[model samples]
Target: MQVLMRPWGAMHYRIDGPEDGLPVVFANSLGTDLRLWDAVLPLLPGIRAIRYDKRGHGLSDSGGPVSIADLAEDAAALIEATGGPAVFVGLSIGGMIGQALAARRPELLRALVLSNTAPRMGAPEIWAARIAAVRAGGVASIADAVMERWFAPPFRTTPALHPWRNMLARCDAQGYIAACEAIAAADLTEAAASLRLPALVIAGDQDGSSPPDLVRGTADLIPGADFHVIPGAGHLPCVETPAAWAALLAPFLQDHAR
Candidate 1:
């Protein structure tokens, strides 16, 4: 575990594996923090894995409104703070941030593995309503709402994933709301064409939040980006189908590692 002081605030992060190995960074989903990668981390070996929370989420100090660029900058800062230019693995808003970073600061990225997110997160009005609800009612109001979109229908019926469902609902509402604003305002369609990084776009077959078609659209925009769909998974593929996600990512990272 590590705490990094950025221009905005102190960002809490976790680092694993030998320092000499290839670096792999993870940018998590909106409501959840670095802890969300627990299942996937063990699957990735021979790499220094990095995971951190966005400002206002998790143990990181809360700050004012944040932009998608701010999220990218924070990611770059984390890289510089811990030996960067890593193969980036991102989910949801994290994927959006990774797109921006890959476009604007290509030098900071070795490769990109994006899950359950798109280049330009369209449908802003829906996100606007979601932000309003989180800000007004706090994260608790959206716990079940997130669960519906985040996991497969069968996972919801399992007792093991229940605690995580409640935890998602209990996430910091302000952080979720602020991150929601970042997603609503971001547009990276033009940037996708310029990306030369080795990239993978993986989507969940049953994910309503970021459906397979949306990920396909993202793949079409980014040059040479590979696309895959995980069976029986939703938005949170790392939790619902960690093994499949790990299998898809391992070779991609191994092929790109310096």
Candidate 2:
């Protein structure tokens, strides 16, 4: 584990595989940390993988006010720390940050994998309300609310997923609210459209958090972006269906790595 402190965020990351291998940076969703990639990492091969906690989450320090661009700067700083440009793979808030990074730091990205997220996540009022609730009552207040949106009906009721749902409840409230603020203020539709990097957008068929239409709209806005939807799973598709997520992502990364 290596920790890199940048102006905007602190990156606590794990680097694996040979230094010479194509580098791939994995950014986790809001509220969760790099541990979110635990299931997907072993299924992946052929690249140097880097998974990190964003500012305000997990082991990383909660930096100052966070914006989508601020998050992007964190990614850029992480790339510089990793020795140079690398492929960026992100989910939810992480995906929005990826779009911003690719737009502002094109020289630092070889490719992108945007999963379970949107360039411009609509409904700011909803975000604001959620943020306010978390600030007032903590993550426990928002946990069940989030779970309903993250997992589909069947998985929501599954006994196996209960612990995961409880884990969601334990996330830091400040981190959750800050991330929501970042997402609410974000509108990267034009930024994504302007990117020249090869990109892939993976959505979940049953995800209400960042539904298929939201992701499709983002892909439609971005020129020449590849889009795929994971069947049956919801927002955390990578967790629920790791193999399927890897199958969609691995080839895109392989094709784009230079």
Candidate whose lDDT is highest: 1
**Runs with alpha carbons beyond 4 Å of true place in candidate 1:** none
Regions of model 2 farther than 4 Å from truth: none
Per-residue error for 224 in candidate 1, Å, reads 1.1
For all candidates, the clash counts are 0, 0
lDDT of each: 0.86, 0.84
TM-score of each: 0.97, 0.95
RMSD of 2: 1.5
lDDT of 2 by residue, 1-258 (tens): 689977755667788877887899998887788878878878777788888888878878777578988888888888898876899998998899999999999999889889988877758998888878887888888778788888888888878677676666777677677888889888888898898778899999999889999999878877798999999989998888889999998888778776
Q: Which pairs of residues clash in candidate 2, taking residues 3 or more apart in a chain or in different chains?
A: none
- Evaluate model 1: give its lDDT: 0.86
